[model samples]
Target chain A: MTGRHDPYVRLLRWYPKAWRDANGAVWVDTLREQSEAEGWSRPSRGEAVAAVVNGLGTRLDARAAAQLALGGIAVRAAVEVTMQIASPGGISVQDPALNGLVWIFLSAFAIPVFGGLVALSRSYGVLSPRRALAVLAAGAVGICLFAAAMWASAYGFQLADDNPALARVASAAIPLGAAALAIGATAGWLVVDGMLSRTRLRRLPRAALSLVAGVVLAGLAGYATMMTLGWVTVGVTVVGLSMRSLGGWSSVEPRVVVRSRLSLVRTLAGISAAISMLGIGYAVTAPAWSPLAENPTTAVVHAILVLLVGALPLVVALGLLAPRPRLHVWGPVALVLVAMAATFYGYTDAPLSTRIDSSVPIGSLALGLSLAWWVTARLATSRGDRLMAGIAITLACVVWHLAALLPVAVFVLPLVAGVLAVRGTLARREPIQAVRTAPVTDR
Target chain B: MATPLTPSAFWILTVLASGRRHGYDILSQTRTASDGRVSLKVATLYAALDRLETDGAIRADGDEIVDGRARRYYVLTDAGASRLEYEATAMAHAAKAAQRHLATRPALLTLAPVIR
Candidate 1:
């Protein structure tokens, strides 16, 4: 029932819109020409699948150097995880099922996921090398020590069961190694995020980028600090690094007016500040929070923490995937955040100290109020200033749990970071704005 | 320097060596010149064309819309022609040596089995 050109049109759709614009008609004509020559009105199903596979592979493989880089990391992850298990003190896995699961996680997921992310970053290149430099340092250190830890464990297992020397070294190394990989993998993602963000805001004026930074910084200084350590960490890291990037980091980024609605971006910044205040009936709010609440914010903070880590990302991911302005490659970003959430879940099982929880809020409140004033005074418009002043006064009061109520403030981390990672990868590899199309279709 | 070209790029250059050709013509002529040994897919040919153009081995000549089917023409560059010539020479030498080696081999080591 499909038209004569339908199959070819579908095949072309496997590629990018810009690609379709340039070569779609001609390419489809060739497919039709070939099919006609073969006495078939349409391409066989095999060709269609091959075309789809080819398109996805193009996004994944990116380039030969990137392919090698990713391939090496995947192989390295196998070595790292193997060493952890083989080493006596690396991990104490007595349960048979858990032990099997550990091995499976090491072998199956580590290489493909981490290496795949690294490969994804290659297509985007290094948008702002600042954060990448930091993540890379962590990853590189992790790699070296991980290799040492792995070697100690593997050799320790072979020589004797009671090798204290190797056990001591590996026990010290394994967790550090995994955390390093998490950091390293995250670095690739941060670069992907930077490139994606750069692409998304390409059409907006430079002032808008700084304003967006100001608003995110406000959230970091205000609401996000209490509930999200990782969220705050990645946020501060990105803001610090991306400021340079937004200023003109990528030489390759095209200087074209974007198809993006610029007003949409300003709305997004406004939304960030409004969501951070959890001042409503402050019960000390969180691990970091309002000192004025004294003890009342505890239960509310716990609820916010649960909501932030648990339900928020899936909601944010769905929101981000909305049509009209979709991010092409977000799978890796989601994967990294999920890993972070898994780490947070691990920490939850261990009881957190009440002293650190209660004591940190008062100090954080002083910091938050002070920061709110500076941000509002220096950057925001009259409307944004009013919102901040309101949030600030609320932070000073037990009258409202202003910053801690909404989990949406926490969602901003995944929203911004996820959106960044999404677009640099295509549906998508390489930012759509970058000149990086042909290597995939390379015959 | 004479670097080895991919088979698809080689055949494409070979077809373009004759004259400028559009996408469909390049596909058909590549099949013909290779004596049905080589066939290029549409996506692949376009990717190859893009890479070759990027590498300065080929350039777009012009465009024509014939009978509602648009065709973009491409011509091989001097770099492409020279590279094609180098590949052809290398292949020719290898082929000549192979034929010489084949001609020297005996039909049967002991005898022709009295067939003659």
Candidate 2:
């Protein structure tokens, strides 16, 4: 009995005892068969090592899912705190400057959401083609009108400054921009119709195509707007585009056909909520700059930036988790509280000592990293090689996120974890192997 | 040869089966076939095509240059023709049953009790 439990038994230790007791024999038999077919004299050391690693990996996957739930809660807490601090007087965009910024953010967000919704509605048979076209037409017109409004506002500012030349130039350009918008809208309608009629584009799933198009268009519009506003330099645009393209390449692969159109709707909603939060962040934070520009401290800037970027991740995560079976009820509530707390700390003129005590940055960072890890790990393990690549890329994203605080950890942890994940996936290592024998009948 | 078809799918497949067409052509064809009862949009046409392709009813035949852009073409497959036949046969049987059931009814009631 002891001999039977030698090398194989030690490998079995890597598996959960309950899982081992249940499926150990079958697993060991499978491994033995695989080893024999591969012409190993016996279960080679490499095969044994792989079996042990893979066994442990399955256990880790189970733990990761549970950890994600907990990590989500922690992140939600931090987000709620942040939101609370940010919404001091409640969200309002009465001020013109703030309102302008809000519109920019809305335009940035709405284009994608509306585009996706139109695509989804058409695909699901909820909307007729004419109606979808109408929606697209209406959306394009609305965008043009918004652009015109922005130009008008700029003109008004110029008029007030007695700068007729600038106003005149803007007036001339407005119509051209509006025309371009109209043309773009019409082209969109035509392209969609043509694709559908011809049946070439229709070969792909509607939601997947819409998602791809929406993301691409939204990114383009965002970049264009940023460029127009001088927020991003040409170099930044080039770099951003390259990064996004690389990300796209990394993620491109076959995915399980998610037949539920509602899931696509949920994803769209998540994107919308993220954009709305970003808009609200701009609305609240932009004005602070004007008022506090003279004596802007590093602490204040840091707090503001944290609150702004942090709002997006928080809202999107909560939005996603809100419909989930287990976390639906408590998730949003906890998230709101954490966002509120963070907002309060951000807005108050409290000393750094008090604010630091109030803010849970470390906890937030840990939660964020863990959630990212869980998401990446799940993708890495289940999706095979493509997802293993994704794990590397996502780790890069994790590092990027972490670089704001602990730059060293960002570089080190992701590299280490990424390498391990890649090795584990590539090597197909299992941490335990079960010994197979004749079935025993219970009395 | 093939059985009768549903009004919508019948019209759609007939339009595509004729030859390759872009959005405007399909919409025009559907409208003409339906006698102005249906006016398809770009979105609806594509959506239907997607479903049809997934069901193995039709496939993209080829593309042609139109206005400096490539316009895709679709051709109906054997599977699609078979499905159309099945739907048509089912409808015809249903219609025949309704006709028989209505034959014993009064003349005024005949018009009133339309088959669903």
Candidate 3:
């Protein structure tokens, strides 16, 4: 016969060590007593399972978050430095090569700083505006240091054939990158602040959440096919997204007793942010030297195209999840669509006789629309809302794909539908403001 | 405002209301107090206890070892007492309303005749 404490100990292992150290003994004794009273030598199966589930739901420790964030940043920085040092023909060229290294070094500043921010956010859910602003300031400072390092290398190291043009571009790109990061972080903080301040919905419609999930998943799948990979990748991505969405939807509703899953979600979010940052880094460094040096216009266009292909999906996902701008959220989206069209026109016409990939712009637009649909699903607190969003995304993807056979003008229908769907959601009578929950008492 | 306590949490609190009680004592008291209406699994009991302790509704009093196993005792706090009082008052009012409605109802509306 198993000792009464053995099964309890095994179950308790799921909890954080800090928690276990404080209450483990009491819990173990309680289990033994209860089992004896019930005439059992071992813990019941139901209780054991509940304990494991409860443990998984606990928020991540601040120390663990800090370590993950710092570790992820270090890895990113190492990858960037290695890639720079190992570039073709080495650093002997001095002019372009050193400039490239400077830019790479400057960009590396984002990794650790971002990791620290993620760790802090994990410790404190939904950072206050002041703290968010502070984080932005810290990020800016890191960027400045990156620039300063670059400037120091530019001035201090004597390299043969110093290139003024590459140096200027590097100088400009660092500030731009920093500004983008600041704007994005600030926007995200404000959204989180708003969401945290408002009443969170206790019960969401399962069908609705699932439907929205389907659209998001399908959009991600379509995006993979259109932008980066083949049908095989698309199938895999769709299946994964669907499974994840189903898992989230079917899980027990968020309970008043404990927001057990918050920590796990936060950890995953931090990891996703790090991965997205790597994608951004690759996008920034993707431009080939020959084309970039030959025609600046082509270089800019290519860089933008690459970003559209590589970085836009993640950006769209983040943007959808974040707070919307007061400009009806459609104004900027409309402008982007117009710009995409103009880019497509240029790709086909090519005033400078440069070959542009037709798929890049179209794929980005399709993927972006799908991501937007997915984001709208977040708003589905009721039964049918997710279903509506999911439907819109699916239709939009279909329309976008139809452009291959039909006129590209058909794509506008999906955009209009998306805008209308969002507008309808906004027009709804105000949702019952959910009461603020007290901080969870136990893990 | 404090939400109504879940049945398990309420039962745990009721057992702890009298005096400091170790986990086993409280578990046994709950089963007896409710006349076997409520039986909490050990995991559920501890989970609730942990929450109660954090909410300042209960405090750990002391610990002792019995048969080489440590047993920790808990006592209800002032806040917990007040909250429990509030819940009891609310329940009483609800029960009174139900009784009043029952007492006033015209039961023999369509009866053919009296039993006499």
Name model 1 segments beyond 4 Å from true. Answer: A1-5, A61-443, B106-116
Per-residue CA lDDT of model 2 for A209-303, tens digit only, reads: 64455444433543444332221122222222222322322332221122232243244444434444443444456556655433445334544
Tell me the chain A TM-score of model 2: 0.26
Interface RMSD to the true structure, each candidate:
10.4, 23.6, 7.1
Question: Scoring model 2 with DockQ, what do you get?
Answer: 0.02
Per-residue lDDT of model 3, residues A314-381, tens digit only: 22322332233324244434434444553554445343534233443354445445444444434423
Provide the lowest-lDDT 10-residue window in model 2 chain A.
A434-443
TM-score to true structure, per model: 0.40, 0.30, 0.37
- Candidate no. 1 TM-score: 0.40
Model 3's lDDT to the true fold?
A: 0.49
TM-score of chain B of each: 0.89, 0.72, 0.87
iRMSD (Å) of candidate 2? 23.6
Q: Which stretches of candidate 2 lie over 4 Å from their true place?
A: A1-83, A86-361, A373-443, B1-7, B17-32, B39-47, B65-71, B108-116
Model 1 chain A worst lDDT run, 10 consecutive residues: A397-406
Candidate 1, overall lDDT?
A: 0.48
Tens-digit per-residue lDDT, B1-116, candidate 1: 46567688889999999999999899899999899988877766776787678668999987777777778899999998998898899889999999999889987754766765
